[model samples]
Target: MDPLSPVYITGCGAFLPGQPIDNEIMEDHIGRVGGAPSVFGRRALRWNGIARRHYALTPEGRWLHSNASMSAEAVLRALEAAGLGRADLDCLAAATTQGDLLVPGHASAVHGELGGGALELASFQSVCASALMAAKYAWMAVRTGEANCAAACAGEFSSRWFRPEFYEGGALIDTKGRLAMAADFLRFTLSDGAGAVVMESRPRPKGLSLRVQWIDMVSLAGRFDPCMWAGASEQGRAERDGGWSRRGPLAAHAEGAIALQQDFNLLKAVIRAWIGVYLDKVDAGRIDPRAVDHLLCHYSARSLREEIVGLLEATHAMIPEERWFTTLTETGNVGSASIWIMLEALVRSGRVQPGQRILCIVPESGRAMVGFMMLEAVEAVR
Candidate 1:
């Protein structure tokens, strides 16, 4: 990790559909919503307390796509909204586990636009640890005097699926069945969009001060990899070519429910232990351990998010009622873009005010990275 001070977020902007996906109409999409009480109203009220969410997706949320480079366009819009232009940046960077392309990252084109500037181009990816890494790199660059300003952008090029089957490519599930369809299109909770933050050494009049104290990381390699993927095989000529190359959180050719439960338990324990240490470290911007305004985490499934919500409530790290972002219900699993999406929600909801401390816990690669930052509002140009 690059050594840096508690950096500040000077400018912030995001793109979600101007309209929101209100819960009142949720059952219209999910099978579970059908038999649930209030049909739509009660569940909408309980669906993570989210009145509506933004999306850069189609009306059905069944397919995944945007005008190519839509996120880049979002960056332009975000920067303009933040009162920043190519002239004001020091670096252009983006993070993602799932990207449209691997070599030339989403930032390459963004950097290309800032002609004649001294801004460097960088890309960081760690499954779900992307945005934090990108932001950390930016903060370090500013603190080390490497750059006067930087743009830390993050977005997810999510595929249309939720069954956890495609994690290992093989046969495709027919999207015709209700269960199969739900498995494929679960990103409604996530409005595919781009978000950017301008980081600077000198605070501008209308910038958001995102004081990041520290970022800690630990790995449990060979842990969830097995749970999420399998390479077992059958004895056949066809199997020789196709077997042992499969992946997923779904049951393997031979994976049993017991194995699934054990793996799930391990992941849960990993999160609990890390947060235990994180919470014990120090005060989080004068807020009570139990009073944490919200918990922004990587986009996990609905059951997992609820499970974590219970855990946070039990440990008093955050109140259950404060679970504001539910990607499972909307965006499916956003891979690495989950945390940034939640942060955007906070900004849009007007819940994150100057000096409000928010905690973002990113659990990926069988490890967890904890980021605690304090937000200070920036001056906006009329």
Candidate 2:
């Protein structure tokens, strides 16, 4: 693929409802919501790097924004930033695991919220890496001449999926002594947010735009079951006696250790493959890891990020610590929206200058897929 073939990002936007809520607020609400009150939520917050997060619902438990509504807001802002309108959009690609319904899809939900249109629509259920996957698909569409311009968006409403009962249900007798339930551990880390980007086939001559240099995605579904899952286990179902459990919890089974078991080797293989694809560039003295100005990564957790970073550095990729960035502490883990949200924040922060390079990686717990994208900033007008 040509580096300057256009299929670049022209605009980006994000929607985070309400103000930042600390662990204190979250604990207070958790205490009143369901089952028994436990300190797991607060403990999870302390264990993770998250100090605060944005929630779509009020602390007192009022519904504020649904997935569709938040996504619509983000899409509108992105279109406006691109100097385009809804009618100008040729395609709308959405990626999300949590939507209003399981049938019509989140893409359809967002499309309907945008007022039914004839644009090409697609919905992806790629878990945490969904938005990045959507972006990759949109880039492919533009590169293949299927669409002149497309919007890739993702909306995540994690608040609704959390089950307070699950948090207080399980008790750990292990040495760690932490909550044995996934809900207890994940409640404080997951958050609600939406983010989007507008990509065009034609690159702007003078402005901040991300050119699609290269993208690679690989899924390891067959190799591992999802560490995080939403449905109930067979053991749980049978224990409950053929009926449904209202507070069906989303489980994060083994946490980071399971992912680390294979990622170290997988990442090495990915690096080798990347070198092979760009070997010509490297031979011609056009490739340099030190030239990478930014490392935008998915917000899984602080420890996981550190382990990955260590691996990257050990592999002779000299990624500067200051240049590496994420939104784990400020926004929690917005799942699929994490990638786009981090990108939007970086763009708005004005840290990325013209001609700089950015390398982003999306790591999902479910299916254990890793997506890689390398892009170059063209120009900065603002």
Candidate 3:
């Protein structure tokens, strides 16, 4: 078997539309609910600790469609961070569960908006797990020598289609709000946003290499399938004349409840399997699970995070004190972008150090868990 060596994440960037809304205003919009805040509208992220979120400005300064606007900005930011340019791009992979539209993938539209990159490109969507999946795909491309550098962008536009029926099937203009009205809760809290990560294979610079090695995908599909479906609403019915449909919120929430359970079970299995393989097959080098210093995990729900962090106290899978970095208080759940966002935060905070092993575990459908265990690289001595 081939040794999946570590791939370096050379750059990272994120973008939120301007005119950020604070938690107070966000609470007000998620709905006061008869003088009391609705329990779940914005409950998922209130104390997530994000200061503000950005959205786009229309001609009249309104928020634009979440995916396209945020995606374009994020890609540019990552490229700049890598000290590279569009000219250096070898591949572009756009990932999003909430896209600009159902028929035409957001990537095609975003590619056009970016003045049409000359590099090869594609789109990836695995619901909330897109970030890790996208990253895995990008890293694989480089690992296989298929590309020199790859960029993956994930935008969480969950709010736009809070009502799966309307978002997936069709949408009707809301006479009251002048926007789609299926989920009133979404309008207030779901800020349009995007995040991007640049992956490349770089030399070790006379020291330990910053690398991503061994991404294994494990899927636990049945638990979350009932909650997963294409959104099909009345407006969508009207738009398609009964063309498509989406998963309802109740089902979504049910799946949400179970999603983390499935994620945890599957992640443990994969890690054990990886270690077992190292001992039985690749016996020369064994990775000490304890050597893992950072774990970037997929953000499922606020409660799920609380439970896992509490339970994993011994291994330091993560800590409750780090909830702010895990749950995305202000950002809410940007689906596939969640883990990448956390990883990005660590990089920006300067917490990740050379030789420190970081494990980024992301969960996808069919019980697919992508694990990227990397050894940090020594930065160039300036």
Per-structure clash totals for the candidates: 18, 0, 31
lDDT of 1: 0.51
Report the number of the highest-lDDT candidate: 2
Model 2: per-residue lDDT, tens digit, 106-225?
888898888856888889986777777888889888888889889999988877645333333333213444434444566667788899999997765456899888776767666544
In candidate 3 the C-alpha lDDT for residue 152 amounts to 83
Report the Cα lDDT for candidate 2. 0.70
Worst 10 residues of 2 by lDDT: 254-263
Candidate with maximal TM-score:
2
* Candidate 1 residue lDDT tens string, 222-335: 232322211332221124343333543244433321111113435566666555655664344443544455556653555556666676665545645544544444433445
Which stretches of candidate 2 lie above 4 Å from their native place? 1-5, 30-39, 163-180, 234-288, 380-382
For all predicted structures, in order, the TM-scores are 0.64, 0.80, 0.69
What's the residue-level lDDT of 176 in candidate 3? 30
Better of 1 and 3 by lDDT: 3
Candidate 3 wrong stretches, greater than 4 Å: 1-6, 27-61, 162-191, 203-209, 222-224, 228-288, 313-327, 364-375
